[model samples]
Target chain A: MQQRDNENRLSQEYTNSVLLNGTLQTPKWWPYLVSILGFFVVIGFVLFGIQIKYGLGVTGLNRPIYWGLYITTFVFWVGISHAGIMISAILRLTQAEWRRPVTRAAEILTIFSLATALVFPLIHAGRTWRIVYWLIPYDASRGIWPNIRSPLFMDPIAISTYLTGSTLFLFVALLPDLAVLRDRTTGFRKGFYTILALGWRGNPRQWKMQVVGGILLSALMLPIFVSVHSIVSWDFAVTTAVEGWHSTIFAPYFVIGAVHSGVSAVVTMMALMRWGWGWNEFIRPEHFDALARLLTVVATAWLGFTFLELLFALYGLDAPEIALREMQIFQYPWNMLFLTFLLTGYILPVPMWIFKRIRTNIALMFWSSILVNIGMWLERFLIIVPGLARRTPFVFTWEAYSPSWFEWYILFWSFCWVTLLMLIFSRVFPLVPLFEQKESEVFSDDIKIGRATVPTIFREEEE
Target chain B: MVAEKNRSWGMVIDTDKCNGCSGCVTACQVENNIPLNDQNKFERGRVMSWIRIERYWEGEFPNVKARFIPIMCQHCENAPCEPVCPVYATYHNNEGLNVQVYNRCVGTRYCANGCPYIVRMFNYWEPTWPEEIRNHLNPDVTIRSRGIMEKCSMCMQRIKRGERNAGDQLQDGEIKTACQEACTTGAITFGDLNDPESEVSILAKSDRKYSLMPQLNTNPNVVYLATVDPYKDKNLGEKAKTNEH
Candidate 1:
């Protein structure tokens, strides 16, 4: 019994050292990676500066095609932001065991991607500087409150609420981990973790409170998660003038699509984390297998929504609506894009994911997840642009949209910015939740029934 | 002079009388201080015309008949662009005019997207004019800057001036919009819909009267009279000859 306890303690110490690699001991390549990502982020800000100074004319936006890549990328990032809540909150409530290792990384992706998503609306506006007026009520002075009916107004409110809630959820989950770092490190880092730990001593009461806080936040954030993407969809959906955009299916379509992309993004992050940190022991093939199964279901549901959107659009049988559909599906460049969107978004990644072998392969999983995002982004692009480009009865006003190189750079910049923030975050905190990993170890056990051994998870009873 | 109570500003456009001269389009640009739309702007699909003459060919080859209709802001009573604007920059006024407040506009282009007529125009760059023609800009109108939406205000400055000039009452013909005044064939008439005796009110009751895209139920103040095409009905031309005989 003494020898067995010693072996368990040694393994526990080994797990702690591996999980806390970034916080306790910085990696050799950390500085180099940060600097490289930092360079790209700086260039992105500079490009934004140029866009502001030169006016929105720098983009390929025109009279009829007022929104282009900016709006598409905005929706994509917001969709990507859905991963955290879907994994950490929804899965937690459902009591999914595999969610433990990925919960933190997914939540971090949610907060950072959401923050990036909020930036696009402001920058895409004609007057970026004047966007500050959107936050406050001007009722006392001008008797003009921001139009509560406007979906654009609702977007910021929903997004900011989600961001705040996600940040709090992240901080709450980080407390015990912070205490771990606080005890392990010295100097500025120790002080940093100490302030954040809030004197979490890991007593029975603190643990109970922490667990309860997480559960309550998970419940609160669920509605916000749904509302954020729904509001984003309404930004386009409420416009009756845009033929393809004004659809009742948009809210659910957007939410499901967001989940599909968001969860895939988490999978991509997990693959990278495993490869980069050499955490093969923690983020095993089983985790990828579980996420892949979740993704297959999500991607399939997303496909059903896509089909429904297209079906109902044709069901109207309106001349303009038909013409718009014809142009979106049959037209030259749009047809190509439509095909690409299908191939990348659903047709390609989903079938590969159905096979157990492909799900367990990290390299294949990474590339397929990346392909899913490419498809999702193209899906948003196809939805936004082709609708705008649809030729109206006023034939003179019909125009095509081609995103400028500047716009492409901005899109690229957004990725760099998100990655940089995530990297910086990883330096301070463990990407995988340490306590959850330890708890999972305790809960997982093998039972031998006759000659067969079955793996099972056992949960502690709540008092 | 008696002040008309609950006056509703409106227009009656006779499409048959419009010859596709595009005079109103030019006049509007001058009167509203619209930025010069050069060849480059046209190429970029950023032309800033407040009023445009849309020409549609009726038939093929020898039977072809060009139909001309001058299109501008319909000024719908239930404007789709109004509610979508986060800043409340555009709204319907008591005078039955769709008003766009320039200073309040943050230019999300959501209003432009909401407008079915494609009348709203966004200023992609600062309004500029060559030094030679700089003095020709209208002093009464505000020159809209870059990164904001601008559209046909129905020449609100002219309406205000016409109201101010009239001591107690405004006449039917007094508040002539820039497009109405410049129309050589008197195709466009501006008047108060509230006054039962007004020409526009009478025209609005005509058999040929219709609003653009009525299916959308916008209930626009600007009514158009469909062109009386004799070629549309072969019997109509024969009936005219027989009646003359």
Candidate 2:
């Protein structure tokens, strides 16, 4: 009996080690790779500092193309951020069993990406300090409130609300996981985990409340996510100057683009985690295949929207619209870039995902995911700059803008910053929810079938 | 209340007389303290111009006929820009003027989009004034910064000043916008449109007078007297009537 009890304790210890020691077992080569990438991040920061000091003048933005890399990156980062809340909230709502291991990473990505994306708009502002005026209900001596008619005023409200809601949701869902970590860990980790756990015991009442709150927050966040991007689209669509920009199609186009880029980012991150942490056993091939199928659907939706936008433009044939479309397709130097985005962002990814071999092939999926992200960024650029560049009447007024090296460097560094944060997070937190996994394992068919067949018989060896 | 009853501002632009030299564009810029169009800023399509002359080519390259239209705020009776503003930064004054309160503009640019005429321009970057040029800056108009929207106010500061001067002299309907005062060919007329005998009112009633995009139903206060190609009308009799109305 004692030997049997020892065997059971040993099995529990083995499971605990897999859960807790995952980060410690990370290969020595990984840190070296991160440090190398960290060097570029430092370089990006230095360049970004130059931009802040020298003003927007450092970039290549000019008269007709007032908005350039900064605004594009702002939109790109925000779009990428949509993945986290989408994966976590959607999976949690649908009760997807596979979400237990992946949701935390996606949630962290959402929170961090949002935090990073908010900075670009502030950086793009002429007087960054005056941004406070955009906040709601701020009573100034000037007796001016934010222009409610302006989407700029609405942006902060939407983004802040989204940030608050998503962060709260992230923490709420993480509570149970934190409690498990607190009990399992020792030293500084234990103390930190204990505080974060908020003294959550495995009480049924506490679990019920957390679950209920998480559901409510998730439901609230889904619409907020959709609304945030819609508001962003309205920033351009609500304008009268550019013909293509004025279309009603912008709201849905922006949302779909957000989801396309977001899902791609989540897939890319998943691939990296699977490779980096040797999470092959946990993140099975089935997960990748499932994600690829979803990606194909998103790709198709994006493609349809693209064609719809073109069809509407053609049907209207307004002079400005024609000119803008021509500039985007034929006249602009970046026409090739746009064509590539269409081919790769939508076309290439579809076939690869639909084909069984390509979906299962990790390398192909990784490349496709990266391509999708790049294509989405280019898609945003194509939408914004070309239309602004081809404003009505004076064809000679059409001017081209090229981003300066400083802009490029800051963009590179921002990616590094996101990577560095994600790396650190993986180290500190249990990337997989241990208790949830245990609960799932306990409910598996083998244990259930074995229990149903036996009646009150104590089978010690069966352990 | 007494001032409101007698005050109605309007402009009549004679398209035939306009040489399209863009003098009015520069004049309005200088009068309103608009920033210089820096090359870099211009390339990015971020240049700020309160009044821009739009030149439209109506024919093919060899037989091209260019139509020059000077566009600014139309100050429409049913101005589309007014209602969409969440902050009420833009509103129509009692004198039929579409007023843009600079301090109240938070730069969301919804009003700019709502405007079919596309007259509004956003200050994407801070207004730059060279040290020497700072002395030439118009003190009457406030300089705009990035993240704020601005457009031609029909030279609102000039109108206000002109009104005050007329008030001091107690002259009836003497105030005129800067563009009206600067036109060398006497092509632009400014006055109270409500008074039937006013210069703008008489010109607005002419058969040649029309508003751009009249089908849009904006009810624009700015009236354009259509350009007549004299050569095309040469085949008509010597006593051919030039004025349609």
Candidate 3:
């Protein structure tokens, strides 16, 4: 009975520390960052407006190289969305106690990153206003239904399903925490939390149902996250007339790439949250270590897939593929750029992650994670542009593609948009999942093993 | 049958006779109201011609072999551009021409990127015609606005005009694309491939007649005759003698 009381006190202390941290006053830089983000967002909006007024000609997109930075960045952001929900769901399923503090940031990142990613396709569209034409069911009178066979059509269906699933999963997890905030807060905050809490008073039934709903949503979302990226890859892969894009292995290749970049994004976000908010006690080096290990595996797998794809294309010597592979190796700018992608995405990071010290080092892990994303972005660029440039087997007609400054600006603001949205999201909600974090405490016990005290997790069910 | 009325339009380009005058390119641009391609357009990889002529150099300068080949939309029986269009902006028509529905295009440009031929062009700029040029514009064709892809329709508008003028059916040699009409050396022949008597159908049977990128089996309607070489026999004779020795 005394042991139970002491445990309760420990849980209370943990809860108070996390909850009180959530209601921290907005930092001074918050407004400055938002304003800066606003300035750039307005600039993007202005550029888009001029683009609409003048046509896509305002951008450097032209013949033979029609899809450029817009499509590449679009794919990158969408791939990043895969990181959050997949990590949260898999870790939750495995009953990883360390996953508790990380889940909200990851899930919220997935939702907003997806929201940001969807905007690119619309922006990339030639007839932006008529984008709705694709969504409306094909009418027989018009002799068209949105081409069900097209991967572009599949994008909307997959992303929306994913967006909906992740949003619900996030809300379900937020409810109990919202109720806690409801009890502690007052005035406008109290009412806001009360309504969002959906009349929860920490009753046994509410917890039971919330747990059941979270499990169901997590189960539903894992496959969806997988399929969302696969569908995005098919948008390129099934454009099989292009050489680098014509591989059969693209779906799995892309799914792995998405997780790789996504985990990097998660690690970067976690590092930012940990130090920036002084929540180091809650989000420890162990989480970064775990993420780094996952990243190493993902990066190795990415390298393996890239090697297999290169070998298969080389073996077949299909004319378009042959020409592109030659360019990938021997061509001046692409050769150097491709090497950069290899170094950043795999070669450099893999060796660093093998050492426990480097993996646990927050700064090194953070930068490497950022580097992986940059390399992944380059990977997307190499996939779309070079393949499109050497589009045909006829050597004389082959063209080279490079993005214009116009495209670079849109891409620049897209990152800002993601960061800006994340910043705003911080103000409204706590970065850590208070309910899950507290519940996670119930499982840990420091058991003496050999010569040392080792922290261990206890599970009621093996699953 | 409805298919019978749908003529399978085909073209025969005799590369042997091509003088590389670029007449066909100019004619197509003029006839279709293509925007004036500036130096910047070429630098930016934005050349907008529906049919472009490619030049190949076979040897070093002193003993060089130069070959000129014109490429346009293949109008394949199994068109890669058709199924990839989410809005059905581009599709194979009853007349066996791959048509672009300009109004329907939302500018995804997947069709342009999907095409192995790289023949499709997008409207990066809203087309503007000078007053005098606007007067000469082909009234039968729609001036495509920004964000939509446009490409060779195999002179579908001219074919429609020819059929409409000819009362019922177009005579074998009556219809001509702008490119065919402008080729001074008679290098281009446009006709119905379904009609065995048509020149394209006859030329298609020749051993020398081959489509661009035939390995893809896109089954292009446009066929090309190999550019003949005067030194062919001498080169072969030397190679054969070497093998015998």
Native-contact recovery for every candidate?
0.76, 0.33, 0.86
Indicate the residue-level lDDT of A355 in model 1. 96
What is candidate 1's lDDT per residue for A1-463, written digit by digit as tens? 1312332332566778888887677788888999999999999999898878878888888979988999999999999999999999999999999999999999999999999999999779888888877756567546779999999999888999999999999999998989998999889878888999999999999999999999999999989877999999998998888899999999999999999999999999999998889898889999999999999999999999999999999998999999999999898999999999999999999999989999999999999999999999999999999888889889788787878899999999999999999999998899989999888877887788999977789887989
Worst 10 residues of 3 chain B by lDDT: B236-245
Q: What digit string (tens of lDDT, one per residue) describes model 3 on residues A147-211?
A: 98899999988888988999898999889778777777779988999899899878899889999
Please tell me how candidate 2 rates in CAPRI terms. acceptable
Per-residue lDDT tens digits for candidate 2, residues A50-92, read: 6555556677765555577777888898898888777888777
Cα lDDT listed for each candidate: 0.89, 0.74, 0.82
| Tens digit of per-residue lDDT, candidate 3, span B1-245 | 54667688999998888988999999999988788788877776677899888887765556667778888898988888888899888888777788888888999999987898889988888877678887888777778887888999888889888878996666888999999999999999999898898888898787678776666678888888776666556533342232221
Candidate 2 regions exceeding 4 Å error are A1-16, A19-54, A140-142, A184-189, A316-323, A330-334, A445-463, B1-8, B35-49, B55-67, B76-94, B104-134, B145-149, B168-173, B214-219, B233-245
Clashing pairs in 3: A138-A145
Best by DockQ: 1
Return whichever of 1 and 2 wins on TM-score. Answer: 1
All candidates: CA RMSD in angstroms?
A: 3.2, 5.6, 3.3
Task: Name the top TM-score candidate.
Answer: 1
Position B222, candidate 1: lDDT? 93
